[model samples]
Target: MTGHHPRQAVVTGSDSGIGAATALLLAAEGYDVGLTCHEDTAGVRATAAAVEERGQRAVVEVFDASRPDAGATVDRLAEQLGGLGVLVNVAGTGHTDRVVDLPYERWRQVLATDLDGPFLCAQRAARIMIAGGHPGRIVNVTSVHEHLPRLGTAAYCSAKAGLGMLTKVLALELAEHGITVNAVAPGEIATPMTGIAEEDAYREERPGNPVGHVGHVNEVASVIGFLVSPRASYVTGASYVVDGGLSLMAAHGHDSATGWRSLS
Candidate 1:
């Protein structure tokens, strides 16, 4: 990991899973971490402890990413950490429902968190970085759904797809300020979101995933680590897919009745 002088970074939804993993990795890579959790204070505390154990400072806050004031949380975190150099928008949510049966509220919530949240956080972080005269990195944690659709992920797919395009536009706007913007799309990673604990073996033989297994949180975090590094200065307006080739199965359609029958 390379940083010109990234003293601080904010990772939203850092209570557990990929967010926690990224926070710890960034801390080890010499960054003071600003962490946020929607409701998991204990999990955030544990994550903060791990950052401190690595001799890096950690500040934790709580806020709902779907709210309009989401950017205010990042503003406060940056102030608490003294400054901000990296902003990783990992706060996101989703629901499983066919578009015909999906509730309006559910759809709104997904878009709010997955798309609106990242835009606001990136906007605030970029402003802070520019005012402070620091080149910055903005990495949005999207999903493989950004490129491919799932059976019952209408809202999730739409939100991620929108975020993908948003990432490119922001990259173009922020390029003049030396602020690189990008997205990371992961698939079937071992995380609480996927109902798999870190100790569990999420790797199962699957027809979709060519690697025949699930991915680890750290695997996704490592890609995020590199994107935010100085080495990736020219790698803006891109979405890095971190799946085990699961997304490549998009072209190969399976029989709905025989292939599998699970929404997950």
Candidate 2:
């Protein structure tokens, strides 16, 4: 493997939320991480500092995975960091509004970041890891919406679903090369990106998921950590769900979040 001791793991959109949590956890597990903050320098530095605290190396980089220049950006970062081994594609965007009401530009923007960005990042990372002749792991951060449909989020749901299939295809294609590809499809997770705080009117108005609440960033990151770790060497081409069983909970008529446990 390429630089396993200082374990190089590149995580996109790592400035905050699940990306940040994942990097911090991976670093604590002895993986030196390459972190990308779209524009959150302070948050990025904080994440890097946490990685350093774990006695692992951390490199913070400015990266916009959605851009056409993603390949070059990743290449430069990999070269500077010595060798790239693990890739966590956590960069994405979401959408709101019914499909008909959604603007064409907005739809394109969501797909560009959520689907295209991860594809680009993974392709570049795969090339480096394969060329280095290292056993590599690539994990795409998908969503519960990958399989479950959500109203007013047609673009997000569609892109995520496609990303899931892409994960499977990539896994199949890369199996011969010793690179593992998988996805972590999380449900409603508590994060800054979701605009999901108790103070948010939208959240307050729409309080509670089928599980009575949403998941935490760490909850999603932990599974991703395991998937990219050596412990999951045999695991690939899979999309693990961390939705607090909400995906399976048919609580459509059960509107109240407090009624989660009453399903049984």
Candidate 3:
């Protein structure tokens, strides 16, 4: 299969952060990677170089996953790579406006990027995988917000929650084809998305996290690497939470400002 390139994968929003880490890991695992980034051309190029350094071919494209042409990019990448063996949906946007004040356009933008984008990309990838007889892996990068409601994150929470459910449904549908579908829910990963500097080696202490610190993109990518590997053949329809026990604190209530306990 073209020397050592035995498999191929398409990862969206892979210019940086968890997406970039996943791409690098997959590349190191000997999969030629196709990546999409909206604005960070330099970051995308760096990721491509990293993949090549790992001895895997890399293709980069500028893609806005929220657009109608989102799926087209996946299809194109898959075509260029000859076929598809993995699809990781990491392209998404988050909105922190309160529901009461959230503009309709903003809500739509978040949902379009986080939910519709994944669905469209997955749909195209699934068709290619099924048609090409490639038992593929589909991993959607959701968030802890998929399971827990966060303050001022109505749109993001809703989109990720919908993506979690979509992963399960896709898993069920694709199982007959031997294709696995899953989600990786990361919480507070140290990435530019979280306002963390790329050069800074910082870990914020979280009282709720048993791990006692924020996660690194590679930590979440390691989980994704496993999920997409042959070792995870039997694992599907699952949402792996990489939050380091942050979700477990849901039972711990917060002090109330109105004399009643708040479950914040």
Using lDDT as the measure, the top candidate is 1
Clashing pairs in 3: none
The best candidate in terms of TM-score: 1
The digit string of per-residue lDDT tens for model 1 on 189-217 reads: 88889887776636444555667677889
Off by over 4 Å in 2: 1-6, 197-211, 251-264
Q: In order, what lDDT does every prediction score?
A: 0.89, 0.83, 0.88
Candidate 2, pairs of clashing residues: none
Q: If both were scored by TM-score, which would come out higher, candidate 2 or candidate 3?
A: 3
> What is the per-residue lDDT of model 3 for residues 1-264, given as tens digits with 9 covering 90 to 100?
111112999999999999999999999988999999999999999999999999999998899988987899998998888888899999898867988999999999999999999999999999998777658899999999999999999999999999999999999998888788999999888888888754442347665566667888889999999998878888999999999887876555563323223334
Residue 133 error, candidate 3, Å: 1.4
Residue 65 of candidate 1: its Cα lDDT? Answer: 90
Query: Candidate 3: misplaced stretches above 4 Å?
Result: 1-6, 198-202, 255-264
Quick one: RMSD of model 1? 3.9
- Which residue pairs collide, candidate 1? none
TM-score of each: 0.93, 0.89, 0.92
What is the descending TM-score order?
1, 3, 2
Q: Which regions in candidate 1 have their CA more than 4 angstroms from the true location?
A: 1-5, 254-264
| The 10-residue segment with the lowest total lDDT in model 2 | 198-207
